[model samples]
Target: MRFLSKKDVPFKEVVPDGYIDIHSHLLPGIDDGVKTIYQSGYILEQFENFGFKKVITTPHIMQDIWPNSSQTITSNLKKLKDVLVPLGITKIELRASAEYMMDDLFYERIKNNDILPLHQNYILVEMSTFAPPINLNEILFEIKLAGYIPILAHPERYSFYHDDLKKYDELKASGFLFQVNLLSISGYYGEQIKSFAKKMIDQGYIDFTGTDVHNYHQLEVLEKGFEFKIAKKITSLMKNNIEFS
Candidate 1:
């Protein structure tokens, strides 16, 4: 018997039944995400093209630059959604959350209950690559005590932990989710980062994968993830609310 052709199958049939993109930057002009509502709409179009079901755009809430609040993110998301409404691009759903920076500002936000957590009470946190925070554990503990699942974003890109991966081990044991950057798997950050990413994957410590799309170049790099083995694994494993679902 002749083999069936891949072209005969519908695109939707091939895609995972449901896609929950946990990390993205679709909010307009908040931190390093999309610059305008037009760009945000563009990203929505891409999500539709990619067969994504639920798109959660995460904006950075950092101290030095993106000192944004939930109100600002909400307003921006509305503008972006309105732009998409005219196109009637209702095939994909959109949500907004913050990629929190682990700094004094994080503590302040937690104390004030000014956080925009992702689904399952998960909060995204990013640390500096060059230096470890003086109060890393304390900050994570505060976030947990505040009732949010802390996720360390792009842990492999942080060089400070090169000598000892134990930092990640400790954080994991302490109950922190780890999100790896897809671009890093493609060596977008560097060879060292790529190595770290591979190590993390091998150890089965990575829980989520994110595009962390800031602009076009990053997206271009991420597009190449389909050819990489680890990337393929991540793409297959990403599911809705897997951490607590």
Candidate 2:
């Protein structure tokens, strides 16, 4: 019997039409994502081709590094939109939000009600891959108190939790929604992350999925990932993103 290769599978087969993309870093120049308006347009055009109906492009809001505010994200989003119209890349609807790093700054933002929500008061959040914040529970409590649903970005990538799988269950019990990265299932981050992603899916912990695309290289990798055997499991979660639409 001839086994099919990953190249034989296409990304469109996994993601359906009118699918809503809940995470990405397509905003140009504000973070580590696409560097210019042109690059942003290129990624969006690819998103359009991949059957994404809308993309909620999230830029990093790490206080020490990116420090992007609602004003900054909104401004760059407008700049990207203006360029996209000229590039004829208007098929996919675009919106802006922040992948907030859970730090002191984020706590303050929660207190001040200064936040850019993804949709319907849901906010995408991330913690250090090295270690979660010492005051994580407090931050999560504040997030809920502020009326924002906290969706943890790429839960499988957190190395600290890899050893203690029950931490995932604790997080779920705490009302944290998990967004697994599409690339992780493709083994783009590494075998460890890839395995964890699969495990998360098996446990039914993944609430949503995202490309988390930062550059052209990653985007290409994302396309190739569709060919992986695990892509079938990831496809099931892809439909969940439309809730944000």
Candidate 3:
């Protein structure tokens, strides 16, 4: 597996007064994120220190791999809230949501309303970078029919779309919004992904930005990326909205 590194990534100098990091696997003891409530508290503190005012913490809801359910996510989020109450560090507002996987199981699960919705009927979804889902269009259509909007997470990272940037255009044309990972542009994912992020923005296709911070190491890499001019200019847009559904 190709893990993103901090050495190849750069940071920005100027951070906005407020930021909204909509992507993260912050729910502890579940997937690959904070291990305990204490670590969760520390990560929230780091978000405040980094100038973000809101965090729409999104945990993975991939059935085959992560196998996370709404009950599991809600339970962990409740514990996280309990831990943060006494800290008196309320500068950052934390909200819970899930990044869903677009597969057959998800396709049916979504119809039954067994998923947690993010930011007003929007469900954050990720596809296998190895290949586009065979029933991609139909699944998206079903999500829309279910009265939910879909935001494809980190579209540029999917290697299958590398040869065809219009694959993203097709998604946009079909009415799905794209929320990019800030680390991708910072070269935390790779040079190719970083360049693709730039291209997406230049094409005016990016609608949102997120830290996608899973642990302290990712935060450190993101911190470095914040120092670069190009990355900073784009990341500064993450603060666009707060207090969403």
Candidate 4:
């Protein structure tokens, strides 16, 4: 028997039933995310319309910048939920976690057990686009020692690692899970990011996919980017996000 031909379908059209989004910046006024309660509501509403069953909004926790704590993130999530319920945008479940910037403060947080995980024992972390920390390996070791699984967020967006593909191997071998930003795959950041994202996906380096959506425009681009055939490759990994649910 001949194999059935595959169709190039828009990602939005074939989104896995009850697809859960693992990362987004839908919290208002906490970080560089939506910024307002109304903005949060609007984004969540759009997420529901896009067929997302759940969203774990991971706000930035950069020192002296976002500096968000679990208290702050939970409070903002409550505020967003309060507004969303009133607006009748409650189809999607909303949870708050933090995208921690690996730094001295982060190391301290790990020691203090001060972290909000995406799920049990899984904390989301990111490196600066400028460079990986000199003690990046040390931090990963500490994170694992603390019984937390360190998931490196948006590894493809870290342009510093793009030219050094072996670094990706080293990171994975070190037991760090990878989360690729859908916006990167969508070419929103640039062709370079999109290309690297596809390459990583092809290499089976990415374990999960996240929207990493900071605003409406990014979400739009992410949706359109799914129209490409390469986007189909991510649909399986998208199922991996339901682990967060």
Q: Each model's TM-score?
A: 0.87, 0.96, 0.89, 0.93
Candidate 2 stretches greater than 4 Å from native: 6-8
Pairs that collide in candidate 4 are none
Tell me the whole-model lDDT of each prediction, alpha carbons only: 0.75, 0.89, 0.78, 0.84
Summarize candidate 2's per-residue lDDT along 1-245 as a digit string, tens digits.
Answer: 99887555677778866889888999988889989888888889998998899999999999889999999999888888888878998789999999999999999999999999999989999999889999999999999999889999999999998889889889989989999998888779988898788888988999999999999998998777555566577677898888998
Task: Tell me the tens digit of each residue's lDDT in model 3 across 9-61.
Answer: 34434445666778998888888877877778888887888777788898887
Model 1 C-alpha lDDT per residue in residues 1-245, reported as the tens digit of each score? 97643223332332354566777888877787678777677667766776777777789888988888899989988877777879768888888888888889888999788888887688888887778689987887788788888888888888878778787888899888898876677678878888888788888878887767887677655554433334345555565234422
Residue pair clashes in candidate 1: none
RMSD per prediction, one decimal? 4.6, 1.3, 4.6, 3.8
List candidate 1 segments past 4 Å from native. 1-15, 240-245
* Best of the candidates, TM-score: 2
The best candidate in terms of lDDT: 2
Error of 2 at 1 (Å): 5.6
Model 4 stretches with alpha carbons more than 4 Å out: 1-9
* Regions of candidate 3 where Cα sits further than 4 Å from its true position: 1-14, 241-245
Give residue 207's error in model 4 in angstroms. 0.3
Per-candidate clashes, comma-separated: 0, 0, 11, 0
